[model samples]
Target: MALLHRAELRPTKLDLLAAWLPSRRWFHGPAGADIVRVAGFRFDDPAGAVGIETMLVRAGDGSVHQVPLTYRGAPLEGADGWLVGTTDHSVLGPRWVYDGCGDPVYAAALAAAVLAGTGQAEEFFEVDGERKYREPSMTIASSGAGDAPVPAVGPPRRVVDADPALIVTDSVELVVLRCLDDGGGERAGAMLTGTWPGQPTPLPLAYAVPR
Candidate 1:
């Protein structure tokens, strides 16, 4: 389960993305375009130290892009290039946000989800010390065999930012779809697909193939 606090965020997530997305080679939207969060889901960190979230955002021109982000209390070592920006969280204090593609925690969590057929985390909102269940903006499922075994994912040996961002680890190659297309993406191997508002049909989000 994922616990969220009812707190404010300085330069909210979208604001940070608006300035960061244009720099990515795979981002086709206008530079500095306004971005609005359309939908998203989260994967729990087994150790509960990192915050993992994947967001679908619509640009000013109606183009939708997928952005996977990870939040940390401190900067990730040797990941200066992948740093999205820093933001102040009311309850959590300072947060270091980075593109999840370059974070090993995200790579491992994603690989586990796809290879082990796990789903998104159950979310809860905490307000005044009380916890309330919150419905996820989107839902996801994996095409992997339920009984399949998942290999331990190591640090990313390489990260390529493209239409489908690639995270090449020692055990598998993780493909994260950067754009949302009606045609969906071609299946590669074990993959995770999601459905959100206005999209009744499941769309490919990410996939994993053995290294």
Candidate 2:
């Protein structure tokens, strides 16, 4: 079996981000914008062949965002559904990017991290302390058949200031959404963020909840 090398020669987290950020849909700037790594941490697969990293980055304009990524030594077949991108390694020669949510290796690692209490976010906040708008809380639920519809777990709650840890449930499929605060200081909008796994240009599902 192949194994991940353990050595300092591995590129720093920022180095990987510098090469990756430009390719994301949420990235708002041109390729030349400077990116600074504010914080980063790694997650390891049990077999030692895959490594996952969650990075917090601040762009030149000082916008902060979170990026979750997985790195593998070789391509994982049957994982096309989760592929994000493949590129020359600059140092390692060739590399493949997989969506951490679908790739089994990454999924297992992520689930373990969440269960172990290692990958949860401690706090969340809005940009510039804005109160009129806010982001939604994200949750990952599992399906038995791998193609089950996501159930409405609960009423939409405020995530404008929640630092939620990534959650992995045995029965729930993952759900991503955005919550907007109504004029009454309560959440009023629910917008679904679809599952893409490795899709590079993912589009959000149309807003479905009542305004």
Best model number under lDDT: 1
**Residue runs of model 2 more than 4 Å from their true location after superposition:** 1-23, 29-31, 78-93, 118-170, 174-211
How many clashing residue pairs appear in each of the predictions shown? 0, 8
lDDT tens per residue, model 2, 84-165: 5665555455667664544555444443332232332223323344323222233222212222333322212221111111
Query: Each candidate's root-mean-square deviation in Å?
Result: 1.3, 14.3
Per-residue alpha-carbon lDDT of candidate 1 for residues 1-211, written as tens digits (9 for 90 to 100): 9999888999899989988988877776766567988999999999999999999998777667889999999999999999999999999999999999999999999998888877888999987779999999998888894746798899999999787888999889999899886444586788788889999898888899977
Q: Rate the local accuracy (lDDT) of all candidates.
A: 0.88, 0.41
